[model samples]
Target: MPAATRERAIEAAVELLGAQGVRALSHARVDARAGLPPGSSSNWFRTRRALLGGIVDWIAEKERADFDPAAMPVITHLDELIEGLCAMVELQSGPYAARTRARYALFVELAGDAELGEPLRRQRREFERWTERIVTAVGITDPVPATRAVMALADGLLLHRLTVDPDLEVRPTIERAIRALARS
Candidate 1:
């Protein structure tokens, strides 16, 4: 499928899924949300599972772009990482915020389902790779604990933002964690 069409389908699906849960994201609904024809979603996405798989990939790609580790300054990688994380939390107010929240929700909900497990596994693996890269860049000799710390912090912050409140600040918390990690 063409990149544009696939991206549109995934975007629409995410929005619809976010607003109404995964059960409401029918092919026709996705097409309507995406402003495409009735069969466009079905033509582009064969099934809801396929559309969700595309969403997983799309979320990974967008997160990677938004948190571009290479774009950070070489010296203050910790600060840069913190800034990237803060920016992500702040993205809760952006145009795609609903999609972001829905994607995570779907990820957790479908994690145990056999049909979506593979895609979730791939998504998590990709996230781990990114986490490992940040750890390595910060010169953390033992990446095992460092990666775990990053994941834990990220997950906590994400949950806090999504569940507790949107205005919740995570920068200080993330910075404190980074400081502790540095001292370790």
Candidate 2:
């Protein structure tokens, strides 16, 4: 199959997963969603697991597509961290909403399938490690736990925006969390 078709299928799968849920994902569904003929997705992925794995890989690539590894940004101060995290929350819940939602859907649906979900798990760990560097530099007392707390809070806020309140103001909430942490 052509790479464009393959990518289209993966993109469609992500949309299906995001718009509906995990149970909505299938080769045929992706094909239909992509406006490709029957068997188009199967021609590339061949299995639901393959498509899902492909989706994870695609998401990881898109997430870090323009990220520069050597140019690690410095979150030198609490206010800087607050602003940076708020921007991240906006990007994750705004332009990347569908993909982010698809990623979270996969995380929940495939939590028990370590074999199939390893890529997603690995991506998360890698994100945490990257987050650790920023938090550590910012002088968070225990960077590891702080990373977890920040990630969890951000994710919760994202979920709330995605699921319940599309107009939720995330910056204040993030600022509050960071301020409370700073006071500790």
Candidate 3:
């Protein structure tokens, strides 16, 4: 299959996973959602596992595009960290919101599926490592715990925005949390 076709299918899969759920993801569904002829997705992904794995890969790709480390400023101070994190939250809450929703939905779906757990965990570890780098750059004494705390705060903030308050002003909240974490 063409790479563009494969990418389209993956994008469609993510959209389906977000708009519907795991049950909504299938070869036929992806093909239809992607506007490809029937069997196109199956040609690219032979099994449901392959399809789901493709979705994970696509999510990583989209996230990398959304959050490029090279494009970010060196976060040497708490204020910079706050600014960077607030920007990230804005991205997650705005343009990439559906993808975030899809990611969490996939996480819940993969919890019981042993076959899909490793990829999800690997993706999470990559995010944690990225967070660790930021924390370490900000002169945190214990980068690991700081990274975890920041990641937890980000997750909670995103979940809150998704569930309870879509219009929540996240920058102030994230700034205060980062200040507290920096002092700790």
Candidate 4:
């Protein structure tokens, strides 16, 4: 099969994982969901681990695709960073909800597999580095820990939005926390 076939499979796999959690994922299910010939996913991935790895890469790519490091300088004010982060939270919980759900599923599902988790770890480290750079540019003294804490806060809020209350008005909270982090 070609790259499109692989992409379709990954996309369909994310849809499946999002709609029904990990139990819904299978080669045949992915093929049917993608409208590809039977065995297409297995043909490309060859193993369950390989399939999960592909899924991680796809989700990570989708997550990072919209972010541009050059945009960091544009956030000359704390309000700008707050707005950007709030927008990100909105996107993750709204338009990209399914992919976000699938990404979370994979995070928990493969939490114990060090080898398989490397891709996830790599994605997270890159995100943190970028966040640290943005924080450093904003003159945050403790960019390292501040970046980690901010990321953790975002993740927690995303989880809460997805799980507890989908209607959470996150802007005020995000603004307060970001401003406090920026100050500290």
Q: Would you estimate the TM-scores of all the predictions?
A: 0.78, 0.93, 0.90, 0.90
- Candidate 3 collision pairs: none
- Model 1 TM-score, all chains together: 0.78
lDDT over C-alpha atoms for residue 116 of model 3: 71
Model 2 stretches with alpha carbons more than 4 Å out: 66-72
In model 2, residue pairs whose N, Cα or C atoms come closer than 3 Å (at least 3 residues apart or on different chains), thus clashing, are none
- Candidate 1 at residue 92, lDDT? 48
The lDDT per prediction is 0.74, 0.85, 0.84, 0.85
> For model 3, how does the per-residue alpha-carbon lDDT over 20-79 read when each residue is reduced to its tens digit?
888888898888999999999999899998888888778877787667678667778888
Residue range 1-184, candidate 1, lDDT tens digits: 5778766877888888877877787899988998987888788678877777677767766766765657644433778777866765677445557766777768776777766656556666777887777777776667778888888787777767766776777888988887778768
Question: What is the TM-score (0 to 1) of candidate 4?
Answer: 0.90
- Tell me how far candidate 1 lies from the true structure as C-alpha RMSD in angstroms: 3.0
Candidate 4 per-residue lDDT, tens place, 1-184, comes to: 8888889999999999988898888999999999999999999999878899899988887767766566544665677778888988888888888898998898899999888777778888888888787777777778888888889888988989988888898899988998898777
- The count of backbone overlaps in candidate 3 is 0
Worst 10 residues of 2 by lDDT: 66-75
Best by TM-score: 2
